[model samples]
Target: AGTVNPLLLFDEIDKLAYDVHGDPAAAMLEVLDSAQNNSFTDHFLELPYDLSQCLLMTTANDADRIPGPLRDRMELIEVPSYLFDEKMEIARRHLLPRQMEKNGLKRTNLRVDDRCLMRLIEGYTREAGVRQLERVLGSVCRKAACEVVEGRQRVQLSLARITEWLGPVKYRQEPAAAEERIGAVTGLAWTPVGGETLEIEVSAMPGKGHLQLTGQLGDVMQESARAALTYVRAHAAALGVEPDCFDKIDVHIHVPEGAVPKDGPSAGIAMMTALASALSGVPVRAGLAMTGEITLRGHVLPIGGLREKLLAAVRAGITTVLLPGKNRDSLHDVPQQVLDALRITFVNEARDVLEHALAQSPVQDGGAVLPDGEAGHAAVCH
Candidate 1:
């Protein structure tokens, strides 16, 4: 620990509790800042220390929880959650064997087939890393050891027995709806744990053109919703919505799982699709999920967490996805299996996405369509 230039890791520094006595994070600025760190003074040492040669690293489940000034000083490298196959391979090659040895059992004493391993990954564990997965494997090893002590020579773990060991599937991924419905669209979202699917629902009622957004959306997401409504209103004539439709009725947009917080620009296209479908009485196409931001001028913009979002869509049995054209090159970062499973369409504007996302083409009802490859709004992700 006293070695020069030792690699120092600050584990979950973001989880530091607020103390009335002092600001630890504020003090960190001096330690991390290279310009000042050469003359750094630690209260513990009460002497000048040079941290300039030391390599420092930190981990956080949610980077947003880290203070802005402190976050700015460090380089952030996002470690994405593993795919199902990756988890399975890791279990077979590393976790399972190590767990067995730790529990005084041999590989031949406990055997788990791919089916059981797959169930363990998809059902028992939910995480961005394999810490929970290792614990689950360790539990299975201990249980197998007990059986061995009972005079059983070998233990063959079956999928049915997995329910007994791990209980029921804890975090099941729900697939998209069976059929298309008006004002309903499936959106992919990135979570603190991993990726998830959100069903955005919209309803129109007779009132004074009011827009209500629900589902614990954050400030940026709420702004995206308002922009979606504005886009729908501005393009009503082109998209076949009555120009006065907004003036005649109040519209409410809600993302299900109301208890969970949902945010980000990734829901922009989905919100616009739901709004367009509600106003035009058209249904969103089934088996399709989308994520991207949209502008009031009807342009599609890139979003963040593309790989995670696409993986979510694939898990949810989505067959098609609409992404911003700017994110097209980012597809290389996604797993090839996920890309092969989905039909991805890249769009530069709203009309292109609506044509692919809606059950029926928006231009069919005596409406015009926006030209392809137009300039769009802000982009921050992917």
Candidate 2:
């Protein structure tokens, strides 16, 4: 069949069957690849057309799932998960007003405090997108509307009321509890929903020094962990680890919050740091954040999202951060106030990060729990 002037959008292209069984993705690839585009419409391996004139937009829940051949043909734009602050602003400017109108309540009658919005974003919802947040707010607005219809003169959304209305808190800020271990590093990650903290826990046990990975990690993160271990072993002296740390120790790396799978190259620095911290018996600095890729020679390679990741640190109440020195240029976009307050150290080598990033100071005896319904976690979206 001959095609029209169609702008094709391959939605959820990643989930399309790509293996064996006739390889639908492989068939679809010819349509996408510029060199082979003419063949898509050709009947007997004939005819050529200007396929470049056609525009294509592809959407996927996870880009990593796309076939490499198909992915290579496209220019990728990443829309990171909304930080709590951004989400609150989104809720305030867009969600709350619309929801209030929908619920037959004026914005004045129902006030969702900025703090309350943050609480909703942090504790109630956990997605890369605001789909759940919107739904939850919609429910709240509907309930408030019902109350107004039943003769309650006013409507209000309070943090305490949120839990009563929404039920038990869905997500906890401290997903991973502190344990007596040196090898675990809390890694901050940007997801489609928002900034999430991941704990990369490493431990040594008796075995032939095997590496075990869990928590449904992806290939890149797994590879990054391997690279981190390699760098740590190679630069043991610089990292303050005995050369044989990996030789005799069977290492197991796990990401806490097992139900929520995590994968990325950005966790490389954290993995390396966790290994170094674990092997050297040094704890990662409390309230310090870091993100970057690592090389085999102990070099700290730059990673993306300097602003999002840094702001993630800030929101976590982190006072210091160790990022790749090469990424220093990206700091110009960061706010000066945040820069001034934070000990943002740039390190070219992964080893140097430990000197400043890992804690020499004692960890605080206990963590402060946010009272019943407070928007805790130092909410910020800069």
Stretch of 10 with least lDDT, candidate 1:
373-382
Q: Where does candidate 2 have its weakest 10-residue lDDT segment? A: 373-382
Best by lDDT: 1
lDDT of 1 at 265: 89
Query: After superposing candidate 2, which stretches have Cα over 4 Å from the reference?
Result: 1-61, 66-73, 78-83, 107-109, 127-129, 175-181, 205-210, 235-249, 332-341, 359-382
Identify the leading candidate in terms of TM-score. Answer: 1
Looking at model 1, the pairs that clash are 304-381, 304-382
- Per-residue C-alpha lDDT of model 2 across residues 1-382, encoded as one tens digit per residue: 2565578787778888745556877767777887877546544566655565467788887787888888888899876555556677788788878888877787666767777787887778877668888988898888888787888877677878888888878877763333334677767786654565677888766557789999989899999999998876776554444455455667889997788777779888889878766665556666666788888876788887676666667666667678889998988766666677678888787657655656542222221111211111111100
Give per-residue CA lDDT, model 1, range 119-139, as digits (tens). 888888888779899999998
Enumerate clash totals for all models, in the order shown. 2, 7
